[model samples]
Target chain A: MEAFITYTLFAMLVATALAAVQLNRLFAVVMLSGVFSLLSAVLFVVLDAPDVAFTEAAVGAGISTVLMLGTLALTSRTEKSSSRSSAIPLLVVIVTGIVLVYGTLDMPNFGSANTPANTHIAAQFIEKTPHQIDVPNIVTAILASYRGYDTLGEVVVVFTAGIGVLLLIGRLGRRGERQKQIGRGE
Target chain B: MRHHLILRVVTKLLAAPIMLFALYVQFHGDFSPGGGFQAGVIFAVAFILFGIVFGLDKVQQVFPTWIVHRLMALGALIYGGTGVVTMLLGKAYLDYSALAHHPEHGQHYGIFAVELGVGVTVSAVMISVYYAFAGRPPRISDEEW
Candidate 1:
């Protein structure tokens, strides 16, 4: 089981790296980036970090994808392959990949129940939370109560984004009326 | 789209349940995986389905762009108002513990109210945004319900 999880994690990392190397369509690249984020979330969950995984999945996969799609809709979808960028980003990626692999040399194996992270504040939170909040779902209790301020800020940020979008696109009423006037040859 | 008999029946029949489920999810968060976000999505899904089936202009008559626009502000007021109430009760902002005889129950009640505000704002915003994108002059509905 442990070996399978490790191999799956390794495969996902390699797949993301390969996608990063191969995709040329800008939209496709953005979608693959979402895939990368989702896989990263899965990796975090495999390490029993559900809260981080939840926020990463929501922000990285959901909000970022929406923002990128909105940008793509405003611009063009094609990646400029007219001039070939054969090597620069690829070399950078390869070097970063190697550095990452080197960094992971001393890291704990995937799904190990005894890592330092699992033994520290994380363990404390998990172990002692029942006594403090009395909520069955510790993650929700923590997110809603102990760390409620962070969630409130996140909600405020979302509300602000709604306001921003309304200011930009909702103001299209006047522009829409102007366009109609032009259409009528006035 | 106008001639699809299946879609017409499905949208008409499904709209009621979707709204019901949205309400259920809003209040039933404790026993389920749903809350404000899911309820809002479900509500928007119903309206979007209606727009797809009957047409956006028809939906506009029922919901009206003006009402949805006001709902955006109204939801925010409801959410922020809770905090104001807490202040009046001699506590910090959004202190739901002051809301009830037992403060713990007040927390549950407070969460529900805020969740409802979120649901309304989200559903209104989503449907209104959809209306903005689905462009045409307008449609004349032969039947009004």
Candidate 2:
């Protein structure tokens, strides 16, 4: 039953991708991408990574969709048809896809217990988290306690990205006043 | 948008609960499947939804751009400050064991503080990005959609 569900989800994901590609309407494509995110979130849940599923649902399906709509509002609604031939781009994509599949051929089978990833420090984290952190959620323990530095780094990266965005497009501080001055032709 | 009665009413009804849920995800993360990043994004969604239904100016009044910009830095400061405090206490950076007499309790404290930092920064960043995108004048009119 689980396999059936997974297969169905993968099929739906492919269908959504195909539909999004085929649609020239930017709005429909955005909605379809949201659908794709939702499907991928469900797949994450089926794979027993609920934390990932939550992030995917919130960030991918929810926030990204809103951002895409906002972008669409600022830009054109329909994709402009390019006069250039797509044959080369299609070929490049196909070749990259094949190479990616070939690269994955050496990966350990899904859910294998003795995989290196499962055999490594993952076992230690699982064993020590209960006593060291006393947190019921091991993912949180690992993310915040064990790997605190990495999480801190991630937060800083987020901060830097926000500042970059604000500098580029956000009207803040003296920049807003300057923009107003330009608008007023002063 | 102003004439979209259903959207306005629905947003009004849903915004508070959505925010409450974000808080739940933020604090309850240690026991659940969610954490700071997801909570932050969810929290931002509420404000974004309001902005979408009402207007940028209305939402900005409630959460001004200045506050959002400050919050973007404040969260990272909190996270880094926690580490600095730990280091000052004679432990390595981000070593939560020094926060309390008991290492386990200290770990809890550290995780809570750090997660809060993550949550704050994420939500602020998401909101600020939304503001940046939505604040701009649209090239196309609503009628185009």
Candidate 3:
């Protein structure tokens, strides 16, 4: 049953990606991408990574779709046709896909007990988290406690991106100054 | 949007619950499947939904761009300041063990504080980005949608 569900999800994900790529309407493409994200979130859940599934659903499916819609409002709704041929890009993509699949062939089977990832510090985290952090969720303990520095860096990165966006297109100055600048642009 | 009574009413109904869910995800993360990043984005989704349904001006009145920008900085400060506090207490940077007499309690406090910082920054940044995108004049009209 799980295998069937996973297969169905992968099929749907591929279909969504293909549709998004083929669609010329930017709006539809954005919506399809949201669907893709939703499918990926489900896949993550099936893989037992609920934390990742949550992030994917919220960030990828929800916020990204809204932001892309906002972007479409500011720009064109339809994609412009490219004059260049797609054959070279297709060849490159196929090559990359083949290489990636070949690479994954050497990976341990899904959820194998003796996989390096399962054998490594994961056991230590699982063993120690209950006593050291007393957190019910080992993921949270690892993210917020064990790897706190990395989380801090991620937060600062988010902060920096926000500042960058604000400076670029945000309402940065006083209302009067902005109005004057708009007046000058006209 | 003014004429879209269903959307407006539905948005109004949904916004509060979404915000509440975000908070739940934020604080309950240690026991559940979510954490600050997910919670923050979920929180921003509420405000973004309001902005979309009711129009930008109304949402801005409620949230204000200035406060959003300030919050964008404040989250990072909270996270970094926790590290600084630990350092002052004679532990390495971000060592939460020094936070309380009991190391486990300190870990709890540290995780809570750090997650809050992550949540605050993420939500604020998401909202701020939405503002930047939506605040601009649209090249196309609503009829285009």
Candidate 4:
């Protein structure tokens, strides 16, 4: 039953992707992409990665859709048909897909206990989290406590990106002269 | 927009719960699936909905752009400051063990503070990005849609 559901969802996901690619209307394409994100999130849930599923639903489906729609408002609604053929890109994509599938053949089967990911450092984290951090959720413990430095770096990266965006397009509210100086081409 | 009676009414009704949920996600993250990033996005979405329905100008009155910029910086400061505090206590940077008498207590405190910082920063950045996009004069008019 689980396999059936997974396969069904995967088929729907593929269909959505193809539809998104075929559509010329940017709005419909954006909405399809949002649906794709949502379907992926459901797949993530079935795979028992609720944390990842939550993030995917909120960030991928929610915020990204809004941002893309905002962008669509700024630009043309319909995608321009390219003068060049898509054959070269299609070939590249097929090659990459084949290589990726070949590469995944060597990976351990899903939920295999003896896999390197489960056997190696994961065991230690699972064992030590209760004694050390005493957090109820292991994900939080790992992200916020065990790998604190990495999370800090991620926050810094977010901050820097925000700064970059603000500098580029934030319009500084009251500094009309500065806004003009910064090149108000848009 | 002024004629969007149903949208305005629904938005007015929905705004409070959305913010309430965002707070729940932010604070309950340690025990649940959500955390700062999800909470922040949810929080920003509430305001963005308001901006979309009520008008960008009114939403700005509630959450000014200057404050949003400051919030983006302030969250990072809060996060870094937590680490600095640990350092000041003669421990390594981000060493939560140094924050409290009991190591677990310190870890709890540190995680809470740091996650709060993340939530604040993420929400501010999301809002600012929305504002940046929405603030621009739309090249295409609403009737065109």
Give per-residue CA lDDT, model 4, range A1-186, as digits (tens).
999999999999999999999999999999999999999999999999888898899888998999898899999999999999999999999999999999999999999999999999999999998878888888888888788889888888888888887777777645778778678665
- Write candidate 3's Cα lDDT for A1-186 as tens digits: 999999999999999999999999999999999999999999999999999999999999999999999899999999999999999999999999999999999999998999989999999999999999999999999999899989988998899998898888886866779899999999
lDDT of 4 at A3: 98
Please give, for residues B46-106, the per-residue lDDT of candidate 4 as tens digits. Answer: 9999998888999999999989989988988988899999999989998898999999999
Please name the candidate that would achieve the greatest lDDT relative to the true structure: 3
* lDDT, model 2, position B66: 85
Q: Give model 4's clash tally.
A: 0
Candidate 3 interface CA RMSD, Å: 0.7
DockQ of each: 0.16, 0.88, 0.90, 0.79
iRMS (Å) per candidate: 5.8, 0.8, 0.7, 0.9
- State the C-alpha lDDT per candidate: 0.69, 0.94, 0.94, 0.90
The best-first sequence of candidates by TM-score reads 2, 3, 4, 1
Write the number of the candidate with greater lDDT, choosing between 1 and 3. 3
Q: Of the pair 1 and 4, which is ahead by lDDT?
A: 4
**Reference-based TM-score, model 3:** 0.96
| DockQ, prediction 2 | 0.88
TM-score of the first chain of model 3: 0.92
For residues B1-145, write the lDDT of model 2, one tens digit per residue: 9989999999999999999999999999999999899999999999999999999999999999889988988889899999999999999999999999999999989998999999999999999999999988999887777
DockQ leader = 3
